[model samples]
Target: MRKEKLKVLLVEDDRIEVLKLQRSIAKDLDNYELTLATNGKEAFERIEEDMPNLILLDLNMPDTNGIEFMQIMKGRDELLHIPVIILTTSNNERDIHECYKLGIAGYVIKPLKYEDYEAKIKAIFRYWSLNEFLNY
Candidate 1:
């Protein structure tokens, strides 16, 4: 049987961070598709069209924040099943707890160093690949 190529939707406003993540994912050259959304509103629009297998959301967007976005996602029957991972720079306890309450699959804090960020991205890939829920 052939494996399905995973599609990942990234919601982030930081250009530099986006570049870094793209580079890290490029290293593996795996069977994956990446889509970017500069803000929560754009993410929502894209989700409405066709939802990705997974979502990497940042907590502090300008138009709409990640938490608010998650709330809306939960309300939509079509989007509710897609797993959401909070990948952000925020380390606030309240934000973390709230994300869990909102049913985030994972919460990852952005690392300061490029190498660390790369490792984190790799780790995410590894984890998702091994996770039974993904049903590869």
Candidate 2:
């Protein structure tokens, strides 16, 4: 039996970051379908149309930030269940604490090295693939 591809919605504002993530997903992960959103507002709209199995969120954006996005999702039944993993540069203690309070599955700090970043992304996908999720 063939396994279904995991749908992933990535919310990030930086074009370079988006491209890097896209490339990393293509190179490291198998059986994943990615959807991109530049900000929280766009992500919310995308989620409304079709919810993904997982969300990769960035903390800071020009429009709505990750915390705001999580808050919005928390109120909605359809979106509340989707696992969000924060992949961001910020390592602020307050941000980390707040994200956990907001119900993120995992918080990953983006690495400076390209190889390290790719490895981290691969690991996240691998772990999630093995784990059973009710919503997916």
Candidate 3:
């Protein structure tokens, strides 16, 4: 049997961070289909249009942040099942604890080094690829 590409939606406000993620996973086309949403509002729109297999969210966005986004998802039946993994600069315990409370698959603190970030991204894909997911 052939493996399906993982459809991922990244929600972030920082243009640089978006670029970094793009660059990090640029070579994994066979394994991933990446989509971007600059903020929570756009993320919602994207999800409504094409639900992703996973969500890569940032904690500090304008208007609606990661935590708020998760809260909204928790309230919605259709959106609640998609896994969300936080990729952010925040290392605060409160942030980590809160994200877990809201049901996140993983929380990764963005490393200062690009190599480390890339490695983390690759590792994340490797880990998630082990699970079976429903195709949308």
Which candidate leads the pack in TM-score? 3
Give the CA lDDT, 0 to 100, for residue 105 in model 2.
96
lDDT (Cα, 0-100) at 16 in candidate 1: 93
Least accurate 10 contiguous residues by lDDT in model 3: 127-136
Clashes of each: 0, 0, 0
Query: Worst lDDT window (10 residues) for model 1?
Result: 127-136
Residue-level lDDT of model 1, residues 1-136, one tens digit each, is 2176577899999999899999998956566678899998999888777768889999999999999999988988878778998999899999999999999999999999999999998888767656666663
For candidate 3, write residues 19-71 as lDDT tens digits: 98889888877888888998898999999988888899999999899999999
Estimate the TM-score for candidate 1. Answer: 0.92
Clashing pairs in 1: none
What is the lDDT for 17 in model 3? 91
Superposition error at 6 for model 1 (Å): 0.9
lDDT score for residue 76 of model 3? 96
Is 1 or 3 the stronger prediction by lDDT? 3
In candidate 2, what are the lDDT values of residues 28-132, reduced to their tens digit? Answer: 456777888999989988887877888999999978899998998898887778899999999999999999999999999999999999889888877766667
lDDT of 2 at 1: 21
**Ranked candidates (TM-score, high to low):** 3, 2, 1
